[model samples]
Target: MKRRRGSGLSETQLGYLMVMPALLLVILITIWPVMLSFHNSLFDYRLNDPTRSEKITSSNILMESYADNHYYLEGAIDNAASSTENEEAAAEVEQFAEQYNSYHEELMSFDGVEETFTTVEEMLAGFENINDNELEYVEVDNEFAEEYKAFLEDSAESLGTYVEEGNEDGLENLQSYVNSSANSILESNFVGFENYIDYFQDSRMWASMSNTMIFTVASVFFELVIGLMVALLINRSFKGRGLVRASVLIPWAIPTAVSAMMWSYLYDGQSGIIAHYFEQLGFISDTSQLLSTGGGAMFSIIFADVWKTTPYMALLLLAGLQTIPSDMYEAAQVDGANRWQQFLKVTLPLLKSAILVALLFRTLDAFRVFDLIYVLTGGGPANSTESISVYAYKVLFAQQNFGEGSTLSVIVFLTIALLSVLFIKLIGSDLFDSRTPRK
Candidate 1:
């Protein structure tokens, strides 16, 4: 008997196939980036250095550099030899070329590298861009690569001084030409695990991590407290409850950047209402001290973040609140439970999942806090307020150190992952089980 095309598949298999697209999308978008970042963290990748701009794990020869520089070097040597016209100078040029040729031959001896090298040279001579990366670059043995690089650098320097002494005044440019020739054949920039080691040794990195933790803990704690109060207040059936609920969300609805800028103005030491009030209220000894002192700046950051994001916490908790049946509260009321007792016995026990969700989100959000601290404190007062995200941004973009920045990024990802696991474990499997739909 002929079977239908899909008859062999089970219902579970069909369900898996149906969801595979979304799972693949998540892996492609989220997991792939993190894996790329992890890969980048292995080497000393930098953007400013032409040779190291890309992530190269293996020993690679920079053929374009060798080709262009060798061409110039050969021409410069000939020009210096001819212009000098002295037997001793000619002998010197011969000696320099002999040593360079020796190393050059060894480099070319690698199978197929000679062909690529010649092609690159021809393209360079024609003023054509070396579009084919493989042609412009080739693999070399790690040991040979290092030896060749060191040899070129030494020869470029020594030949510069030697040729300058024996050449004519008109040939002064030959020395510079020879010296710069070494730049064409760049060495392997791969420094495996060095970036991580350096970051571990770095005090600034640890300090930034510390600051991130402080901000996350402080902001999340305050937000949870204030948000819970707001959630409870709005959860009640009072007059104009709709208006109150809408008003409560105003702070969270504003864009983060706009909120940060607004707080920046409000935190201004001079002629700012919030700062002026804080000074009068004795929160600070002086108004001008808010942004100037390290502790004060950290305080200002937490205050700003809490104010800007607490409404979001309230909103999450409110969703959780709505899920709990009113009968739970009514049962506690019938048992002669007070509002506080009812909340502790019925609300909190049931709201554990909601709390976990809110804390996980807010904690991660606070851990990665950038724009708020960036706009407010600018990680100032001697970088005392510098969060890990800000530090990563400074290293990745400001310093153009992609390898180290990627390491920092991986650290942030791992930290968030660890926190997520912690939250899930503490909340237990029941939290998720409770979220499942009824059959």
Candidate 2:
């Protein structure tokens, strides 16, 4: 009988199937957002206001409506005041006529000036004849008369001036005023790319790039060194080795945001234990604020990064360490090789693949570091800690300059791609060669 083919899978197919879900998730979460961000960078997007919206257009209309209402209401109030003054003047004239009539009758009834009537006595008698209501009426009339005289004088002067000028330029002046107002309104409607250009040309970009490079290179280098040492030490048999390894991983297990926040407190100038201890040891001045200075801030960020990531580097190296054979070390020792010589010749040569892999992973991660620096310093003290990631974020989110933000992001992406390609060409292929099986 012919044997049936079983449902057995090849190692490569099995491995691919196992990673497919993770690969799909990576594309969905990381790659998709990056692609979306790139697309948005092409557009000049404003988050605060929707583009081409009816509400924005309506705002202009509402402003115009208010301006029109203000002008018309002011004109109406002035015209009403003028009409009231004219009515008051007409009433005053009528009152004057009534007073003149009464005076004339009194004068006619009296004998001639020689008929024993003194001027002072006649004035006092006329005042007494005026009733309280009539006196109040006369007082109000006089106030209006004074105000009307001033108004007429001012109006006459203005009218005379206008007549002398012949009002020849009034239409041209009005048209020019309207044209300027229209230009201002149009200017408000159109936005410019000056901010984008300024952001690209500024020294802030280069400064941030330099600081970021230093941070990434230094932190990755030291973290690798220390992590390799720790991994090597723990790779050997020891009591409670599992507990020690687990303890070391605690730093890495803590979230980056939480770790950064914890470090910020530890670096606090006033009451921080680290600061106080360092000061007591004379490592730094007592008055020193770690985050206040550029160098100190850089150091603080690097320290935080190493503290959080060293365990991760060690874990990677430890995985590689487990693959190495103990026979190689035993053989090297039988050849009269000391520990240092054995490490240099046997251990280091074997650990090259692990070191390169760890370096590559850590370097890329460090290059894109933002959380630690952001939480600790917020790119403060004159943007001393402003990485390319932070700069891109500020342009895209804070300034809402998506176009320029995209430009910066493209630059960063290109740089990372070039570095990755170069690194792979130099050492990555050999380091990850699967054809050569380890002993």
Candidate 3:
């Protein structure tokens, strides 16, 4: 006599429901940042530029700047006008002030603007800095901003002329104030895809991308070859194998920045043992060439990267080597296959998945190489080793150009994404093919 229970979700639906939280977390962590970077890339955002500091879709007035400038502007203009003995010059100055006053009056008439302006004026009188949420950046009609900017520019020019000819007392300061006030009235900085277009045409961007490709390809290639050999060597049962395995991981275990710093000293022209040896071996004409020339710098970074990460690659491949059944190798030997033939037929085929995974990880890491190159070569020696990541960091932080930097960031993301897709496709096909049930 109990009521019948309704059916719950199907197995597939329940499975999806269980994973929804994790799926949302992954999206928030990965997709949100990429989307934010794309959004920033569409505008002319820069910290050094007050007008374009924030992403603006319409004309706006920075009330803090407007209030501060207006306070000084009125006094400057009045004093200059009163000081001029020439009736004509005085009358013209008065007319300019009147026009400016009318514009100010109109701006103050906007909703919430007058209230914010009054608050800012009060703060200024008290010599107090405006705190967050206390001041408001009021948006206005684009036409109005243009007109006000034009009027301020004209007023500044007239003031400059009056001051230069000694027609008015100290009008130069007033001219500067007027100019600053004009700048406070910002125009829409949003220029969709303009940053992207500019980067495509930029020579430095292409150069950085080329450097990234070269570093990625060379470093990953060497790591794969050397790592395979190391993995093969360590896979066999031998005395002190545990110690050897632990020793191999020392370089990989060191922090990248610290490793780079250590290598920087080793590559130093005057004191480094590696550089001295390279010189003695006739690889270079002088020890200094190791880090002071384009080829040498590229080689140095690749060598350092291979040395540090080869152990990691070996570890991954070693895991695959461990998974192979001992019987497979014994069976190959019983079939009259030599060691080399057995390795070619059995080891390589079984190790494919691990190799693919290692290559994918190493390739991505090398492509985004920044900290190592940044700390060591500093993208110097004529920027021959500057990776795209380093270039983006310089633009984003050093120059404070967020818009262009965001464009660079997006490009890096896209390139990494393309590489990931390529690797996944290759790996996915092999894995699925291998795991498919035999007919």
Candidate 4:
């Protein structure tokens, strides 16, 4: 007999209803912000603006803003000015006179003089007497024309010399002029990309990147090696093994920031226990300071990370170790395999999947490392500990350059995504498959 149809929701509809909450959450938390960031990346964004609106939205405006702020405006301005010929020079003179008259009117307004001076018009009519007969000239109220002329002459001479030598000094100077002019046009608006560019081009970026990589690789590698050894030792039945296992997990269970702070105190040269011990052991000449240098600061951070993380690695591997059957080791021993051979042939091969999972999690965590470095060195000693995240934070919030800061963030995100994909392809995907089946 055919069954009667129930309330009639299809499987697809039920599935959609089940996932509705998660889908809504993904849009709210991830998709919306990503779309907003991409939209903001297209414009010139300044963080200091409470509104977060782009004053300049077009690519032309964005490029112009960047060029103006970073002194990259010479090529365009020079090209435009050079395209004019002798025929346009007379027209340009009249235009310049009109602009000067407008400026003079504004200046007079500032002084409470509402009426335009007829004498000023008469003086302007005698433009022939003006040096070079160029309308670019303007009469100053209380300024030395000779000094201005000398200044222009010196600037021109320097620019010529720079061009002859193929130096970019002239270009930089021209770009500065453009920047000042553009800023004036924009009513002295704060364009924050200047500081962002400075931070990006600074040596601090490279120093931080290098320090982070070294700390991450060294700490993770050593943690894996040492954690494995500890796991193996603790896996065996022994007196006080439960206490030893709990003690090892204590470091891992402690908050990372708190542990870093504790280590910082220990590394303190004046009153730190570790520093005093090192001095007594003759490892250093004195305990005046331990983290003053770049090397010392990096070592301190790495040591703290390894100390806190190794127990976690050991625990993860130990879970896998417990899953291995005792018969494998017995058979290896029966086949006359030594301890080293048994480890290489039986333990390591059996632990491949667990090791890969541990490494994957640790490596990804290491890549975006910021807090430990922040607490330990505060990206100090000339920013030797400045990770990309910290640098991006300073640019976005401190220097208030949202556009460039977003650019750096996008770069870091891409780097992490690529690394994660590579890790999965290399090891994560095949981790379980690599394990040998038990007989």
Task: State the local distance difference test value for candidate 3.
Answer: 0.89
Assess each prediction's global lDDT (C-alpha) against the native. Answer: 0.83, 0.65, 0.89, 0.64
Off by over 4 Å in 3: 1-7, 81-102, 105-135, 154-169, 426-428, 434-439
Error of 1 at 23 (Å): 1.0
Encode model 4's per-residue lDDT on 319-420: one tens digit a residue: 999999999999999999999999999999889988998898898788788788778788776776677777777776787867766766665666677878
The order by descending TM-score is: 3, 1, 4, 2
- Model 1: CA > 4 A from native: 1-6, 75-98, 115-129, 155-175, 433-439
How do the residues 288-382 of candidate 2 rate in per-residue lDDT, one tens digit apiece?
56888888888889989999999999999999999889999899999999999988998888888888889999888899888888898999789
Model 3 C-alpha lDDT per residue in residues 1-439, reported as the tens digit of each score: 3333255556667778889999999999999999999999999999998778888999988888989899999898888677777676677778888999999999988888898899888988998977754475788989999899999988888777767777455477778899999998988989999888889999999999999999999999999999999999999899999999999999999999999999999999999999999899999999999899999999999899999999999999999999999999999999999999998999999898888888888888889999999998989889899999999999999999999999999999999999899878866457556665679
TM, every model: 0.86, 0.63, 0.88, 0.64
Off by over 4 Å in 4: 1-35, 49-203, 432-439
lDDT for residue 421 in candidate 4, whole number 0-100:
92
- Per model, how many backbone clashes are there? 1, 0, 0, 0
Model 3 per-residue lDDT at 397? 95
Better of 1 and 4 by TM-score: 1
Task: Pick the lDDT winner.
Answer: 3
Which window of ten consecutive residues has the lowest lDDT sum in model 3?
Answer: 1-10
What would the per-residue lDDT of candidate 1 be over residues 274-299, giving only the tens digit for each residue? Answer: 99999999989998888899999999
